[model samples]
Target: MRRIGFLGCGKIGKALVRHIAEREDMAVEFIQDPGFINDIGVQCPVLAKADEAAFAGADLIVECATAQVLSENLELILAHCDLMMFSVTAFGDPDFERRAKALCGTYGRTIFIPHGAILGLDGIFDGGPVWRQVTVETVKSPSSLGRQDNRRSVVYEGPTREACVHFPRNVNVHAAVALAGIGFDRTISRIISDPEVSTNAHRISLSGDGISITLDISSYAAGAVTGAYTPYSACGSLDRALGNGAGLRFV
Candidate 1:
């Protein structure tokens, strides 16, 4: 993220500002957030939208916006530089994913998907071919899942592709899991809105003829949608993506 910029200035974006504030490199160049006003307590200027100058200087743009926002601005953003894509749920649509990949090629740009809140992506990518099935069950607070239910309930259950369409903001980890392992349609995703849970949790189960693995990860976050540890994860991902020579990197 050389002279980086941010597409959204929400919790994750603001937290990332603080995370990399002291770094000599990877300093914030511009922030594009419509609702953002008042001092952000950072040295960077806030823009409602980035123009040519802002995009020209920025080698990478970190998108903390919603899936819809990414889809809307995909071409314009890619035209300038690489993108650290957080709204990976946008790729749940097979056509959108294909178009995004094609655009990356056309513009000579890259898109890096950071390891968000969940863990074990490395294992999934490695074990995918031989594994017979992969399933992930994610449990989050009702509010986190954008629900107001008084009782715990299963909000979504089915293939990862459809789950992303239903819960674009919440079930991104499921999308990540699907992308890392099997394709979106092949991976099973279950999202439960549990009023009893205070944290966002994921229970991933993988099985094959000779190997079986179960992985669980949870995070008590500062915001409803993003996990507390995500800022650090993004920072690490930015470092990994920048260090790689060219094209996209999954970190």
Candidate 2:
């Protein structure tokens, strides 16, 4: 059985942990959340400090918290166990990304990034070096766009680097697409705030090597910045990470 630790008790964390707990092959060992209380209702030890002792027996740590948390407790967490990261926007920093990869290499621990709130990553990944251009257009409600507007608006446009900075938590799907298909600077991202749109939508367009691909996915919005399908996406990623011992693998 896999012993899993959680780094947040918020919406995505709670949802992911709950799903993991329901699985017979996994055990929720510890949770680190400063604002956590009994109200979280998960049967696990909660820690205020993310120290080595806190994650002593944890085989894996899933971070559903802010990118700040990833940067803050990275070394200590990596020293203890492999990590499943939901806050992948933190990798927008070249130094942090390089350092994290180096640390994972040094410690022989894997860092997993889920394809959250999007689809068709496998096709993009399989396309490889042939990719000429990848563009992602994300549309959400005004509230999710962090704006109070009555009309539709184009909130942001540029590379993934600036997009992540402007909408850190909201543009994780963009970062995932960039990491999977093209480099951050090369991947163009456009964020739209549509007052009439009731769902979160993503349009991924790629062109290269005599192939033109476009994938559009829409999911009901959970909040201004979150889609209902995100939790399920995280779970799917987790299932892929924990492979069957003898079954055919499909990823």
Candidate 3:
């Protein structure tokens, strides 16, 4: 059984913990979430905020925590084992992104960025150097955006970096798009909170010298901030990252 460590046990993390609880192929080593509760039947050690040293026992540590947590323990996590990142928005900071990649080299550890709550990430990544411009326009229910607005409103608009700063939890897909396509500074991010939309929607537009492509992805909400499909995405990412060898990787 693969020993797995979880950095957070929020909605998505809890869902994944339950999903793999009974699996014969994996075991939960420990969990480090301040807000974690054992509502489900599965049992594991709930680590404190300062006990990251326990991570050395994990084959792969899944980070379902916030960008801030990831940033704080970047080197420590990489020193222990491979990491599957849910908070891709943390890379919105060019310095952090660069440092993370460098540490992956230093520690011979891998950082896996998951395709969360969206599709067509492969094509976006394949565009690579040819990508001159890229934009991710996301729409979420007003409640999802932490607002009570009854009508549609553009909550944020700017470079992907700034957008991630403004709406870290909500517009992570845009940050993923930026990483896969052009870059944080070049990629455009537009976030809309609309009561009319029944799903969390992301529309990606890629423009290059001779190519123009658009992709639209949508998912229902399981919570105000968690997408119904996100937990499954995390599971899939974990499966793919199980035995990865060194360096930065996208799952």
Which candidate's TM-score is highest? 2
CA RMSD, predictions in order: 3.3, 1.8, 3.5
lDDT of 2 by residue, 1-251 (tens): 99888888676777777788678888888888889766647888888867788676888888988898888989888888889898878988888899898999888888988777877777788785889999999989888877887888888999998898888888888888888888789999999988888899999999998999999999898445678888888887877877633567668
Candidate number that wins on TM-score, 1 or 3 = 3
Itemize residue pairs with steric clashes in candidate 3: none
Superposition-based RMSD of candidate 1 using all C-alpha atoms, in angstroms: 3.3
Per-residue alpha-carbon lDDT of model 1 for 95-174, expressed as tens digits? 88988999999999989888888676777888878788989898888888778988989888899999998899998888
Q: Positional deviation of 32 in candidate 3, in angstroms?
A: 0.9
Whose lDDT is higher: candidate 1's or candidate 2's?
Answer: 2
Best by lDDT: 2
* Candidate 1 deviant stretches above 4 angstroms: 37-39, 244-251
Candidate 2 to truth, TM: 0.93
Give the candidates in order of lDDT, highest first. 2, 3, 1
**Greater-TM-score candidate between 2 and 3:** 2
Worst 10 residues of 3 by lDDT: 242-251
